[model samples]
Target: MSQRSFRRSIAIWLAALFAAYLALAYFAAPEFWTFRDRGFRTQHFEMVTHTPQGIPGDPINVGLVGTQKEVVHAFAVAGWDTADAVTLKTAIEIGESVLFDHPYPDAPVSRLLFDGRAQDLAFEKPVGAPAPRRDDGRVWETPCGGGGGRPRWGGSASFDRGVGLSHDTGAVTHHIGPDIDAERDFLMRDLATAGVLISTGDISGVGATSTGRNGGGDPYFTDGEAIVGILKQ
Candidate 1:
């Protein structure tokens, strides 16, 4: 081929590749593309949490549409124990659970802020009691106040497969698994099996094509469709 023709072909291919990239950037995850306009009430999703320093945390995967009492009852029926409030005794329990290889099913979770406060509710399902790692849990919060008789709560769920130091802060943090979507589904199934769910639905703008790191730099991913469920009293 002539030199001029070869260069022209290469240019065409590069243009095509660039166009494809642009298309993806525009049409892929709505959460990232339209991040600026996100509001908890209007948008389908929101950030999972924020760091103590106010950095963005994880992406919310699961949401609940019910009153506080209903939420507590649903999780109870699903065989999940409420996480103890963060206190000195609870802190010691978690430490012993890790060091002495004992089970603390109701271990207190580290604070993850939503609406400038820690989670309103937390629940956990122990895995192989006393095991060092691999436990399923969730942190839930009601970001918007219940007004006009509408009470809604939402948050993220993840499995702690291991525990390690944070890459960014060097503080100990839970190492969550990449397949966060599975954990979300697991919670739904548990609620359904217990006959506590009234209805289930999905909302958009939370899914992302690529995995993301949280404030602690733990990797996670989601379907972008927040699983929302209403519970019965």
Candidate 2:
């Protein structure tokens, strides 16, 4: 090759390497510098489980940094009803809701896991919406802790826009709204309104700019900060 061409090639390679380095620096450990000084825990922010067919599930958006009882009490104080366990009877009731145009206040929800196990608690605020329509609910699971101390509950709350087959896995799933932060903020507001939140902070559950798709391929977004709520005893 000519000398000029060789020099130009070298310059292009150097520029590409520098650009790649910058991109890595921007995304790598984003929560570190972004949240280092923040008054919140930064761990436990990752995509843990997939759909029932082994596809990725929803991102963890909110957390309850208290005991199981405190968590349950806070939701109860917020007027959210416990969702019925997914069973034959509950399934039949849901079917009836769809067919008879009824409202099932404590209808069952599709299973989602936290730390490899199904959620320990699930709650929903009845909006008097029809089945397979816009449904709003929250799910919680205590993955660890409880040795004479408060346990942390990892959870996700979202607005279900509709019901359809998974975009990725083809399994039946609820389509979630794009603005998950809205739902997270709604929960925070509900708890604060009910005087259940003693203290609150932030944590890194998912890195910044992660547009996650659940097992059913429903897209969700967040500001990468997990809202940690300490319930009042």
**For residues 1-233, what per-residue lDDT tens digits would candidate 2 score against the true structure?**
99999999999999998777555544433333334423222224344443333345667878777776888888889988788888999888877887888788788778765554667788887566565654355555565563346777778877777667556434455677888788888988899999998788887866665567765667777787778787776
Per-model CA lDDT versus the true structure: 0.70, 0.69
Error of 1 at 34 (Å): 24
Best by lDDT: 1
Q: List pairs with backbone clashes in candidate 1.
A: 206-224, 207-224
* Residues 1-233 of candidate 1: C-alpha lDDT, one tens digit per residue: 99999999999999998777555533443234235424433323345566554445666777787777888888888999888887888777878888888788887666776666667888888776552354445556565653345577877787877677665455556777788789889888899999998788887635573668775677777767778877775
- lDDT for model 2: 0.69
Superposition error at 178 for model 1 (Å): 0.9
- The best candidate by TM-score is 1
